[model samples]
Target chain A: MDNEMNYRKSLNKSTNKKVIRIGSQNYVVNAERFKEFKKNVIAITVSVALAIATFGYVKDNIKFHHEKVDISLEVYDQMVDKGYKPVPADGEWDYRYELLDGIDPFDLSIYMGSEDALSILQYRGYESWDDYAQQEGYKNQRDWYNAQKKKVINPETKSKGGK
Target chain B: MKPLAVGEMLTLGDEVEYVVMSRLNHNNKDYILFANIDNPEDIVVRIEKFENNELCLMGLENSDEFDSVLKLFGDQINNSL
Candidate 1:
């Protein structure tokens, strides 16, 4: 008890020294400044950690995006090769086949010299042979030409129109 | 064919005539889907084009190439239908 009293007395006498022994450092500490400094350090550490995590997440997402785009491009190219065309996003649309223009399918005169012209007429010539065939009542243009060989129905050609 | 725009008439060695339904180019090669102007079954032939405006149709001998082309054509055809 006497020793404890002596130590307490010494501590009281050393009040003017105004120094705290913290770990191995004998220094005066300002409680308010220490608290503020500790708060700033914690805040900085958390912000850096969050920043690193966010960067990693963003990088992963970008890689995934690139891979998705690459796959889509590959699929699109394959579709094009297979004759797939993209539909218009918005406009007048219909389910029926619309005739945009007429395709002059070989202009039958080109096949006049063909050996199989008679055979083709005997086979494929029909009401739906083409735009010209539908307009005219000619299933066999070759037969029509043969029938009108002497007569001139079309003044432009001085012969019957084959197509 | 009404739907296909290829209007050129192709005469074969057998003196049979055919019309093109569609054509595809892949890996520096051309493939044609044609049907006899008479008998209507579709036939596929590989083709080589020369500067002389001549197109030589070759029978597809490689089973793998033929199968690939057939599958690709079949997908598009089915989708269109």
Candidate 2:
């Protein structure tokens, strides 16, 4: 019995596999189970990461929140009713923009429609921007617009350096 | 003062959003106005009520009415100033 025990102990040491002895029984730890568990953990982690990334991409591209969707829907319907056909989503269409946090004023030109702009001002019965500015109690259109913006663009610098 | 007292944000034909200035009640008829916030420009539209009582904005082609509205605004300005 001692000889057999010594032989098994030597075999276990040579194989580099863990072996557990309980009373008169020997139980070998299964390396395959541990390898399977590690593989599953890695696979689950990768899948979760992929799912999160895909969700973000879809949300940014085609998904709008319910409120935006509803407002846009009504706007689109009214536009269609006014004989304005919905063109394919094009670059000319400035439908989406980031919300202003009130720190940086939005550039009105970005949202200005030249046609609407001219007509609206025309309604004021002014032949030109300068005329409108003076009649409407402003120094100029630029001044009035700046007043509306409540913030000035790049201020002019006094000439501190001159040859 | 804004050219249009009451305003709503609207997207025009080019898919740009703007605020329609005001709906003025003149002689029991409504006139809708659009103004560029950044510029002192405006579009004046007379209100047209459809068979279903749905109101739509139409260009103010009537020169007489246009003059009247302009005068009204001038009066308001004078009063405010």
Candidate 3:
């Protein structure tokens, strides 16, 4: 056919060039440049692809290097035997009557483990927060603080600060 | 140069085939989301342009542009979901 002959002629004319295919169309390009471009494209694409894939995999499976260990109950029991009490749950103390007695609420330092907090915990038949946290198997006071913050302190249905 | 449409496919020099999933314009530039035909989950975004009368798919020039394009695609995908 005349069309087949023309196609053959065109292909024979560009013997030094490479055909770059995009979808269904083809473009004749410099053979050496096309090879270099393909190499660069493959390298960059493989790297980016690996990065994107590893991101999803890492997001789901990889944990922070400094992971907090679960509290060891055995260590906790030993501390309890040494006369340390566990940190009290909400509503364990009644500060309402104390407030009425003219003791400053600020002096209680309720959440803060200040000297006032130490005194209050001691008065309530429990050891100081530092001792309790150590007894509770926390690595350090900071670890205890962070762990306690994440815990649901008080439910709204259960009133606190009252007898 | 022929602009690739969604659902169209192209084969690279390595013989790996990719299918265009979506196309959009952001910051006055055009981009297309394409994935390995064999592995649909393996997706990559490229800047769509024409050079010397040939369609070219190029990597984003900067991370800022990459992030913006990523956000645009993320928002669109999230909305669909």
| DockQ, every prediction | 0.01, 0.01, 0.05
Q: Which residue segments of model 3 deviate by more than 4 Å? A: A1-163, B62-64
Tens-place lDDT digits, model 2, residues A12-124 = 22222222111111112346633443455434333333332332333322323333354345545644555544342553433322221121111222233333334334544
Candidate 2 per-residue C-alpha lDDT over B1-81 given as tens digits, one digit per residue, 9 for 90 to 100: 122235344433323333443355788765554432222222323443443343333445444455455445434433433
RMSD of 3: 19.3
Q: Tell me, by DockQ, which candidate is best.
A: 3
Residue range B25-76, candidate 1, lDDT tens digits: 7777666655444433224345444423433345554544554564555444
Point out the worst 10-residue segment of candidate 3 chain A by lDDT.
Answer: A61-70
- Model 1 residue A76 lDDT score: 44
lDDT of 3 by residue, A35-101 (tens): 5445555443443344344433332222221121112343334334545443444735333222223
| For model 2 chain A, the run of ten residues with the poorest summed lDDT | A19-28
Poorly placed runs, candidate 1 (over 4 Å): A1-163, B1-5, B51-53
Error of 3 at B44 (Å): 1.3
Candidate 2's C-alpha runs over 4 A off are: A1-163, B1-5, B48-53, B77-81
Pairs of colliding residues, candidate 1? none
